[model samples]
Target: MGSDGTTAEVRCVAAVPCWVSLMAHDLDVAKAFYGPLLGWEFEPGPDRFGPYVHAVTGGEAVAGLGAASGGWGMPVAWTSYFGTESADAAADAVRERGATLAVGPLSFDAGRVAFAADPAGAVFGIWEGPLGRARRLDLLGAPVWIELRTPDPFAAALFYGEVFRWDGRDPERFEVRWEHDRVVLRAEGHSVAALAREQAGGPAGLPPHWEVSFAVEDTDAALIRAEELGGTALGPAFDSPYGRVARLQDREGGRFAVISAKP
Candidate 1:
């Protein structure tokens, strides 16, 4: 059991995004930036992945923060984690589907973990362990959505569908459908994520990546707070079909988004 009395053992539904993590150049700095902006507190997490902590809000783990030291030399970015029953098997599927397996299906105190990049070079992680009660997709300050910005949304969907067994999964709980120009993945009748074609060859163009969006009470207020905390608003808050959204970059150049909570 965890210190909070929650069971440390949880079998998360395989192939669903169970957690999200950010590797920052400095752990304290990341905490300081997010603490005030999102009303997040911190708690100790597994150190097997380096100095790591769980970002807690309302006594629930919303995200993870890790210090990007020890010659890791990776970019300071947020990587989304999908839950799996077998980390090694997922890693194998990643390789078989022509994706690059970057890290290990190594064992940690709570569970096994691995990292991989899709064919489009978008990096993501896999965890075979306790999800705790951190998988909140609607609560304020928790990750609400994850979007895949890639060259071809259809092809990307195909790749992920095979890797995660999205097609063969129980349809009542997990479903995928094409909505307009994007491919949407819904868990339990609610939209959890989407894949859309990325912008190309422009100043605003972003590389193929998975963008994580957090829930906020006020989009404009969050952007203002982000600037005051040394983060940049990559773009102004704009209303999407989902909600008012703003893209942001941390002081160290990690990109993420914030969306205002629905009434």
Candidate 2:
């Protein structure tokens, strides 16, 4: 990344990174959803890989907007891939270790990227960009968390547990937990997200999905900004035992969260 480039805050891994790609059914629709929700700025780019909208947060590319294809009969939503040192090497190592390969060791000069699923079936991405930055915080707090809602929690736990060398375990709620949750991970070497298995036949619209958490100074302010801007409030802003969160769908179908940890 050029110093003159928009990604100037390379120093604050504590703030936002560039944009995340939201996979949606329609390009403009997706943009409509996010444009105001997160208070993002979009840049025009070639329509090769997607209508390929560059969503700007804080004057830099914060997330991406793209049209979706088949990955299952799934519609619109956002998912993520981790940034790796050598995506090819990471993909090869994961595959050799029994993980299933989905995409490629192929290169993207923009970054070295690949897609794959862990033993438990949760997917993640890897990219060591030209700047070599992994996760950055913008309006979304550097993707502070990742949650996988899968049918078989234990199975998914066992798979990723071995693959990521994660300590997988279950603890009943309110028992004084140390980031206690299934599928625990360290974001930038700090504890970030956890995983949990959904009960069989759990309520509507829930499937094996990954939920990402971004940072916000005030969830209420962000929520107001989101609605006033044109994003859909998929769920009401709520407080959990964990943190304050508001779920949203950008113009298309890319859903992500803006969270603020309560002291």
Q: What is the lDDT of residue 19 in candidate 1?
A: 79
Give Cα distance to truth, residue 68, candidate 1, Å. Answer: 3.2
Q: Write the per-residue lDDT of candidate 2 for residues 60-83, one digit (tens) a residue.
A: 565666774444355666656554
Error in Å for residue 189 of model 2: 6.0
lDDT of 1 by residue, 89-194 (tens): 8899999988999999888776888999998888999899853332556678888888888888898888888778787777787889887478998887778789
TM-score each candidate.
Answer: 0.92, 0.69
TM-score of 1: 0.92
Residue 248 in model 2: shift from native, Å?
3.5
What is the C-alpha local distance difference test score of each model?
A: 0.81, 0.57
> How many clashes show up per model?
0, 29
**Best candidate per TM-score, number?**
1
Show where candidate 1 strays beyond 4 Å. Answer: 1-11, 131-136, 200-203
